[model samples]
Target: MTPVLVALEAFHVLRPLWLGALVPIAALWWMVRARRAHRAAPRDGLAPHLRDALTVGSDGQRRVMPIDMVCVALALLAFGASGPTWSRQPDPFVAQSAPLVAALKVTPSMTADDIAPSRLERGKQKIRDLLELRAGARTALIAYAGTAHVAVPMTEDPGVMLPYLAGLDPAVMPEEGDRPGLALDSAQALLSRETGPGAVLFVTDGLDPDDVPALSAANVIILSLLPEGQGDRGLEAVSDVPVIAVTADGADVAQIDRLLDAAQARALLDDDRQPWLDRGPWLALPAALLMLLWFRRGWTMRWVLMVAAFLLTQPASQARADGIADWFFTPDQRGRLAFDRGDFRVASEAFSDPLWRGYALYRDGQYADAAEVLSRVETAQAAFIQGMAYLRSRSYRDGVRAFETALLRDPDYPNAAENLETARAIVAYVEEAQEQSDTGEDRGIGADDVVFDNESGKGEETVISVPEDGADALLSADQWMTTVDTRTGDFLKSRFALEQNRPAPSAEADAPDGDEPREDSSQSQAPELAE
Candidate 1:
């Protein structure tokens, strides 16, 4: 959806009743105008010269009056009170910006040097610029040639996405063809799993004519990697999707940003769970300027000054007592403001909500208090926080139990399994050390706070949990994950090959001939590179 269409669909008044005030205001203006006209009526049979002499100014009859200003100001205020809005608040659990999935074309054509370094490198740079523009927003990467695959999963950290993005190569793809249709499907699948609506960005030089159908169906925005004045003729057929031509400057990326915002606005409008965002305050600006005219000579009213004085003095008095903050913000709201500013200690002090308070406490390094507060919350995220709190406090057993609870509640909770294993290993290491120590008391450095010593010098050679070179045997599921020496191209090739070889339910029906021996599926294959 474009922003114009979204605004057209979403623009509405929250408090429609306030508009009724306009009726009386209009009537009052008309009555005042009629009364003034009657009072200013020329005397019966008066000469034109005498009438002109009686008027102090030539255009006095047409000059703006106090009633006109009052009516306009009141009308503006009434319109503002109606609470006009065209967008809503962002999802509380998600960032203000929408999630984005960038589907990049890793093909031989993208390596062409029509412009600068190459189309592929330029696309990569554009993606980097986009990441900078949309920091803290979740984004994913997809690479497509003959088939599409996720190069990187959705993540808020640009560092994680950038490494995989840089590693993508046309040679890494399992097959060779421009299959953006498949890429769109992959992008959709990734977005389908998101809690809120997201947008897909296609960074490619051109698209196959047949791919237009798939492109037309979705709200994908295309960042044309093709040089200026050059484009895929097939894309002109796409009516709904916006194709932003590549620019040397940031204009193209700015268009992509707008499309992403439109997606978020659409989500806000469609979700009944959230309320329409009130934009009533925007109307106050014009109304305020109109009221300023009342300060002129012969127009100043005692009530206006009284109201202005009261509004001004009231805030100072409220500031002294903090009553204004109390009136405008809840405790949790204040805590969230503080939390966003990195003042976790103040956030912890202000938060009455157990989860936020506990999280704030944890960030502030009050792990003991965090664990105690978080234990009252039953959610998986709360359990995860509590578990980390325990780990920080050197309560390995408690940390293990908390992690186990989190896994039981939500097995997919990120990093929960790895932390659980670490806690368990620490506990095991402590027990083993206790058994080996001759004094039967902790004496030397162990994991975290646990210590063991060989005072007797009789204990067998002790095994360390993780090596000094930074092995994750004490943490993650697979210790070899960090040790893998395989290049990203090789890793992606193997991953895509596995998917390509997997049997599909419609394999026989879709194949040209089920009885014939299977041949190579790649439309074009690059020569194998030497290791």
Candidate 2:
């Protein structure tokens, strides 16, 4: 079938109920109009004057053209509002087959003419055959002589490795002897970042003693290109790994096919496969044109203009709820607006984008949750935000690590160097505090040990003890106070005074004549916690 026909066949409505209801209602409306026109007809035997009087005010009968036009316009509008779609959308999390690494030996021995062509030429042909057979799998190419090097990184398209494979030679290597072990290590390094199951295909005539240990630990298929009678005894002795031997003269296609089948079996499974293109929104243009044509009849244009105005002014969430807006204005847009307004909790809940959600959680003082969300995102901003979250949660070691990662991504990242220094200072403070608490030393107040409640009329002081087990609890308590009231920090400082063997400051003493005390200008400002 043609492409247009295929798309038309796939066309479906998101809201079919609107069209279904309109059909029956239109039929009922036409029947009722027909009956009313029949009843209003003049009687055959009526007097001329009476008939003239009855028919004078009436236009002979209602025109079917106007009613038909109205019904057709309404039907078109209903179809347009139903949301027609024809193609599938691409999803980022779609599963894929495991990547394959081809470790080809490029030593001087491969230049031998055992077959009609050289062994190296025949080996390249076999690699091409394997790639064609496993079309969906991502492939990487590695060349090894004395040292191994990656010629092509892992990619879904196998054609990328073909050019590099054509020029591969032993002269490119710095060292001289066969070292297939290094090639296997290079393949492993390439696959380390991938979470899926993978296979290492070792294409060589023979293996060295050192290569056997690395081959034992890997899921490998050793392809031997020796002549019929000559068998590598070292490979035959190793029973743990699977080996596929193909003689130069009699290289059967079936043997290579079996090798590919084994590689695919060892690879990862895929899920929720979908087409890459989404052609649903293409229908909107034609639907809009049809609506414009209907507006040539007066008053319809005004209605359309009013609807456009309402949608433009309405909040995205309300527009979506009322079915006036589509996926174009999604929850992520709403979350960004909420974040700008300083509604962190609302922004966190509204955001579908993972990066924005993590940032919102950090702003809401949910540090542990923020760290968990930010860990999946690999960006300098995400690392910096994660470091701030860790620092606020009293995890100084983790904070230091996160800051170091941010600086590595961008050395001139704003505030990263300063935060790193502050994180180190906090680490030292935590260690010193732990030692002091352990030895029970300095019961007498020091400069850092106490915070005086100057607003308290009784001149009470609060001791700030950094207990090993109570760090998270103290942070939680501080967060709760900040959430309840902006000026609760001093109240908490005074409340801690009661725990330090000092007299509790009464509410009456803090406020004279039963009125609240004057707010301190310095206390109203946010404290610099990074230092």
Candidate 3:
């Protein structure tokens, strides 16, 4: 198709409802204009001379510019603000194939020549076919005789599984029994690392009815290589899963193809697919240029200026009523830009939106401020962030409270429970340290004494004693506390200072103050408490 035709075909309006609202606005405008004209008409009983004096400056001539021009401009502005869009361009798909584990039975029963080749060899062939059909899928192979063992770990390359398939022998198995349950368990273990949908394909003669429920949690597909007379009715009765039985002559290859097709369709349907691109902003430039033409000095310019001023002066919440702010830089968008550049102070100031202001403060290392800001929001995410802020600021009791609140809001919130335990441990240690200081036993402290290595899951304790020299030993015990506290406080205080002193946002010139606000000396003090 021609480019123009294609563009025309793709064109669509995002907010058609806004266009409907324009009808009532136009009607109101017309009614107000008529009312003004009617009120300005001279009284019927007035003398001609008196009327002439009252209308002294009136030229009795029509306006040079028609009111229709203003109406047309308003209509164009409305259409542009409604978000006109066109031309969908396809984005590259990030294909994610579900992991598949093929569990093959290596018992003596698999050696029976029910198929043209032995049952074991046929089962191996089917597994190879499945891997080839599911190209790019993460696959694993498990061999089972008495117990199950992972013959191959999960890998994208199907060829890695071929070596293990050829090496499968019943004699190699240390025990002899049919335990499909153990094989399913091994498959689940292999798939635990993967975060996508998973399936377990059983290539065996049959499975125990009781063991079928264990594989019910995952997608299960059974490929039976039993003899023609040995149907899979018993297995089907217990498990509501797909079972494809292959004879010695291999008459059910088409059924295998159908099953593979269905599986691929399901995967594509459930995967997280990206949405179409929005082209609404492409129309904004033309709309702006058209409005600029109406800025000529005249009554038309005066009317346009009045409308523009009214829109600009409206409060932020009211501006969003007509989506006017959507066409300009929103506070959240400005905050995100500043945050990305690591200018968190400016980001916090820019984020007038209550939802994101707390996060900006947290990133700025204003932990106490962040906790206060987030308390009002009171969502699971807000509570979690508040917990982190409190914890980093050495408010262990408050941190525990915030984390518990987060868990109450959402029991499955990640890391809330773990961090709560850490906070409790810190609180206990703080009490212990206070007791020791009161008893005059351990006056000096080391860096390891205060900091807990949560990542390594261990705490280091190291205390430095005072020298036995006569003059140094005579110093008060309180002096030792001051010296040790300074060393530990330096770590956090320096990091806080570094964060506070980052360069201002790139668009600082456009801010209300035209520059970043300077901090006073009083605001730079570091606390003596341990962190």
Candidate 2 deviant stretches above 4 angstroms: 1-96, 247-531
lDDT of 2 at 487: 33
- For each predicted model, how many residue pairs clash, with residues at least 3 apart or on different chains? 1, 0, 0
Query: What clash pairs does model 2 have?
Result: none
Clashes of 2: 0
Q: RMSD, model 2, all Cα superposed?
A: 23.7
lDDT (Cα, tens digit) per residue for candidate 1, span 491-519: 77787677677775121221122121111
Error of 2 at 433 (Å): 49
Per-candidate TM-score against the hidden true structure: 0.69, 0.34, 0.36
Which predicted model would earn the best lDDT? 1
Cα-based lDDT at residue 529, candidate 1: 8
lDDT of 2 by residue, 1-531 (tens): 223454566678767776785776599567756765676646789987888777742552554433455456566666666666554442212212346788888878888888438778878888887777656456788777765666666665667667677767665555677878777877887766344567788888888765687798887778887866777766766677867776543344345445544343323112123332333355455555555555465425455578788989977654445333325557876777677556779989888877788878976789999888988888766787788788777777888889889889878766677778877766665555554545434445433443221121232233445444754634436545675753322432333234223354222221113211111111111112210
Supply candidate 3's per-residue lDDT for 181.
Answer: 82
List the lowest-lDDT window of 10 residues for candidate 3.
519-528
lDDT by residue for model 3 (333-407), tens: 777667655577988988886547887797578999999998999677778778877877877788888988988
Output the worst ten-in-a-row residue range by lDDT, candidate 1: 522-531
